[model samples]
Structure formats: C-alpha cells, structure tokens
Target: MNALTGVLRYLGNYAISSVWRLGYGARLFLLTLLYSGESFKRFQLVLKELYSIGVLSLVIIMVSGLFVGFVLGLQGYNTLEKYGSEQALGILVALSLVRELGPVVTALLFAGRAGTAITAEIGLMKATEQLSAMEMMAVEPVARVVAPRFWAGVISMPLLAALFSTMGVFGGYIVGVVLIGVDEGSFWSQMQSSVDFHEDILNGVIKSFVFAVAVTAIALLEGYDSKPTAEGVSRATTRTVVTSSLMVLFLDFILTSLMFTS
Candidate 1:
C-alpha cells in the first residue's frame, strides 16, 4: 500500500509539472507578444541582446559553418561524382546546412555558450538577492532581464543561423567549384533548381526562432528561481542546460510535425 501510494504521488507530480510547463510556455508567448508591442525603449533591448548573442557568437559560428560546408562539399562531391551529378554538391550542401543542420547546430552551440551563461549569471544573481534588490528598487526584473534575453534569443538565433547557412554554402562553393572542378554555374543552377525557399529553409529558421524562445525561458526561469545558496545556484545552472536542451529537441520534433503535417 505504501509503495502504491508513492507511485500515485509520483504520477500526480508528473502530471502537475507537465501542465505547469505548458502554462509557463503560454505565458512566455503572451509576454513576448506584449514586449513586441511596447515602446522603442523597451524594444531596443532586443537589439542589444541580439548583438551580444548573435555578433559575439560569430567567431565560433563561422568556424563551425565553414568546416561543415567544406566537409559536406568533399563528401557530397565524391558521392555524386560517380553518378555525374557532381554539380549537385551545392544543392546538397545548401539543403543540409539551411534546412536542418545549420540552425540546429547553431542553437546547440548557443545553448552551451550564451544559454549556459545566462542561466549561471541569473541564478547567481538570484542566490545573492540582487534580483530581489532590483525588485525592491521598483525595477521589474522580467522587464529588465528576462525580456531582453528572450527577445535577443528570438531575434538572434534566426539571423545567426542564416549567417551560418550562407557561410557554409560559400565554403561548399569554394570546395566544389573552385577546387573540385565543378563549374560555378552548374553548382548555382543545381542549388537554385533543387532547393525551395519556403518549404525547407524558412521552416527551419522559424523553428530555430521558437527554439530560441524555449532556451531563453528555461535558462531565465532557472536563474530566477535559484535558491539562496552557492550549491543551489550551481544546481540551477546544470538544470537550466539540461532542461533547455531537452526542450529544444522536443519542441523541434513537435514544431516539425506541426509545420510539415496536416
């Protein structure tokens, strides 16, 4: 009987947590729309955060994108060369980079770099009562901290993903056309003919934007809810990464289904 009671309690808690997470998502969506409607002074914070996340993250993004493109070109050219579709290297590279790999990989990297940092910094602040102090100062912490981070993530993830895709495609072109003896016109022509702008690429970017929102929310919530202790802050940081990454992956599946299916 005791064991049965524990199982029931566990199931109840799981159900509650799931519903709580759903509500949290709905609230964040509403808050984001509200922030989008606010004054320029409020909206400008998005740009500031965007610079920090998107611009500051450029170096790593470039390195990852360039190498991925080069590798794709090498492999894709080899694979298609026997079939007389070496020109399709550009199309392969563009599809993989833009439609799937680029945004997802970039978001994973962003979660590690900016996402972890946001969680740790905010969690530490919460532990130290800095957030509380701001509240006492009549500063709405969400408006000042969470809002900027949220908007920043939403705006920057898509742009950075685009940058990664473009650079990766450029790298592929260099490898395929300049080095591998494929004609530039053939490469571009194949890519243009094979890739559709709306169905594949745009959907991926939109998904990445939603991913940005999820990661920001998980990280900020972890930080905001940290207990008043060093250990607690540390725990929150770890939880933030685990939770945010899981949410990104899960939502990617959900959003992909919703976007592609009837």
Candidate 2:
C-alpha cells in the first residue's frame, strides 16, 4: 500500500512538472517570436548566427549525406538486382533520401552539432550573468541573443536539408552508375520521372522547417531554464541533443502519416 501510494505520488509530480515545462517553453517561444524584430533590425546579428550554426555544420552534413546515399545505393542495388529490377535503384535512392532520410538525418545531425553548441553557449552566458547584465542595462536578451539564433536556425534548416538531398543524390549516382554499372540514362530518367516536386520535395522542405523550429526552440529553452552553474550548463547541452532527436523522430512520424497516408 505504501509503495503504491509512493508510485502514484511520483507519477503525479512528474506529470505536473512536464506540464509546467511545456507551458514555460510555449511562452518562451512566443516571446522569442514577439521580440524577433530586433534580429532583423540588426540583420548582421542573424547573419553571424547563421554562419555559426549553419555554415559551420556544412562539412558534417555533406559527408553524412554522401555516405548515407552510398549505403542506400549499394543496398538498394543488391536488393533490386535479385528481383531483376536493378534500374529502379535510382528511384529508390532518390525517393528515400528526398522523402524520408534527408530531412530526418540532417535535423538529427544539426541537433547534435549546432543545437548543443547553442545550448552550451547560452548556458555559459547565463552562468556568467550576462543575461542578467543585459536585463540590468535595459536590453532584452531575447531580442538580442535568442531571437537571432532562432531565425538563423529556421532559415538554415531547409537549405541544409536541400543541400543534403543534393549531395545524397550525387553519391547515389556515383555508386549506382559508376561503380555498380547501372545505366546512367535509365537511372537519371527513372529518378526524374518518378519523383514529384510538390509531393516529395516540398513535403521534405516542410519537415525540415518544422524540425528546425522544434530543435532550436528546445535548445534555447533548455539553456534559458538552465541552472546557472557549470554542471547545469553541461546537463542542459546534453538535454538539447536528446530532446531534439526525440522531437525530430516524433514529428517525422506525425508528418509522414499526414502527408503520405491517404
């Protein structure tokens, strides 16, 4: 009886805490958006953050995209050849990357790379009372610090996803056409014929955009809410990665179901 009561109490506390955090995060997101005008007023602030988060993440995104495409090409060829449908491998790789893997993988990588960096940087600033200093000086930290980063992530995500998809298609072509001897004409033609611009490509762009919002928001929230200490900053950075990854996967499923299911 005591154990059961204790378990119920723990569950209630957890539920309440989750709800409170969710509410707090929603409020923070709204405030960031409300204060976002300052980010554009000083466009250089956003441009700086764009370089830090987006440009810095390019190498990893491209390399991972290429390797993912290579694997898809190889595995897709092997599977298709068994059924005498080898030429269809191009469509397979292209569709998979454009529809599913591209945005999801890119967002996951962005979370681990740029997302953690944002969280840690903000967390450290908080630890050093920079945010407090800004508040004292009559500056809105959300406008100057948070809003620029938010806009940067939102703008960078879809572009990065597009670049990732492009590199993936190129990698797939190299593996499928050059190495595997799939007919280059048939590969390109089939891929072009089968992929619909609005259905596949646009949906992928939308997914990446959604992921960008979720990831950046979560990272910012974690940092802003972090305890002002060294260990707290570290923990907030770790949470940024884990939370963003889970959000991407969850949102992917929801978006896929809505977009693909009849």
Candidate 3:
C-alpha cells in the first residue's frame, strides 16, 4: 500500500513538473517574440551571431554532406545494380539528400555544435550575474542578447541545409559519374527530372526553418531557466544538445508526414 501510494505521488509530481516546464517554455517563447522587434535595431549583433553560428558551422556541414553523399552513391549503386537500374543512382542520392537527410542531418549537427554553444554562453552570463547587471543598467537582456541569436539561427538554418544538399549532389556526381562509371547524362538528367523544386526542395527549406526555431528556442530557454551556478550551466549546455536533437527528429517526422502525405 505504501509503495502504491508513493508511486502515485511520484507520477503526480512528475506530471505537474512537466506541465510547469512546458508553461515556462511557452512564456519564454512569447518573450522572445516580444523582443524580436529589437533584433533589427541590433543588426550588427545579429550579423556577428550569424557568422558564429552559420559561417563557423559550414565546414562541418559541407564535409559531412560530402561523405554522406559518397556513401549513398556507393550504396545506391550497389543496390540498383542488382536490379539493373544503376543509372538511377543520381536520383536516389539527390532525393535522399534533399528530401530527408539534408535538413535533418544538418540540424542535428547544428544542435550539437552551435546550440550547445548558445546555451553555454547564456548560462555563463547568468552564472556571472551579467544578466542581472544588464537589468540593473536598464538594458533588456532578451533584446540585446537572446533575440539576435534567435533570429540569426532562424535565418542560418535554411541556408546551411541548402548548402549541404548542394555539396551532397556534387559528391554524388564525383562518386557515381567519375568513380563508378555511371552515365553522366543519365545521372544529372534523371535527378533533374525526378526532384521537384516545389515538393522536395521547398518542403526541405520549411523543415529546416521549423527545426531552427525549435532548436534555438530550446537552447535559449534551457539556459535562461538554469540555476545560476557552474554545475547548472554545464547541465544546461548538455540539455541543449540532447533536447535540441530530440526535438529536431520529432519535428522532422511530423513535418515530413504533413508535406508528403497525399
């Protein structure tokens, strides 16, 4: 009886805690929206953040995209060769990268790399009482700090995803046409014919944009709500990566279903 009672109490507390956190997240999101107007006024800060988040992330995204495409070309060539459809390798690689892997993988990488950095930076600011100092100075930290980072992330995600897809196509070309001796004409032609700009490409951009908002929001909110301590900031940074990755995967599935469902 005591165990059963304890179990029920624990579940109730867990449910309440989850609800409270959700409410906090929603409130933070609203505050971010309120401060978003100030982002343009701090355009230089936004540009700086864009360079930190987007330009610094380009090498990893490009290298990963290329390797993924090369592997896909090799694997697709093998699989299609079995069915005597090796010429379809281009379509296979392009569709895989643009429709699914491009945005999803790039967002995941961004979460691990940039999202954790954002969380840690904000968390450290809180730990050092910098945010409090800003408040004392009558400076809105949300406008000066969080809003620009948020907008920069939202702007960067789509461009990074597009670059990833483009590099993947190039890598696929190298592997399929140059290395494996697939017909170059069939490779480009089939890929061009099969990949719809509106359906596949546009949906991919939408997915990346949605993922950007989710990932950036989680990163900033975790830091904002963290305890003002070294351990707290460390924990928040870790949570940024784990939570952002999970949200990206979950949102990707929902967005893909909505966009692809007939």
Q: Per-residue CA lDDT of candidate 1, range 1-262, in tens? A: 9999999999999999889876876775576556554423767777777778778888998888898899999999899988987877888999888877787788888888788777788777787788889999987677777778777777788888888898899999889888878989979998999888788788888878888877877777777666768898888888877887788778877877887676
TM-score of each: 0.87, 0.98, 0.98
* Span of 10 residues, lowest total lDDT, candidate 3: 33-42
Model 3 segments more than 4 A misplaced: none
Clashes of 2: 0
- Each candidate's number of clashing pairs is 0, 0, 0
State the lDDT of candidate 3 residue by residue for 1-262, as single tens digits.
Answer: 9999999999999999999999999998898889988888779999999999999999999999999989998999999999999999999999999989999999999998899989999999999999999999999999988999999999999999999999999998999999989999999999999999999999999999999999999999998988899999999999899988999999988998899999
Task: Give candidate 2 misplaced runs (Cα > 4 Å).
Answer: none
lDDT of 2 at 261: 86
Candidate 1 versus the native: TM-score? Answer: 0.87
Instruction: Arrange candidates by TM-score, descending.
Output: 2, 3, 1
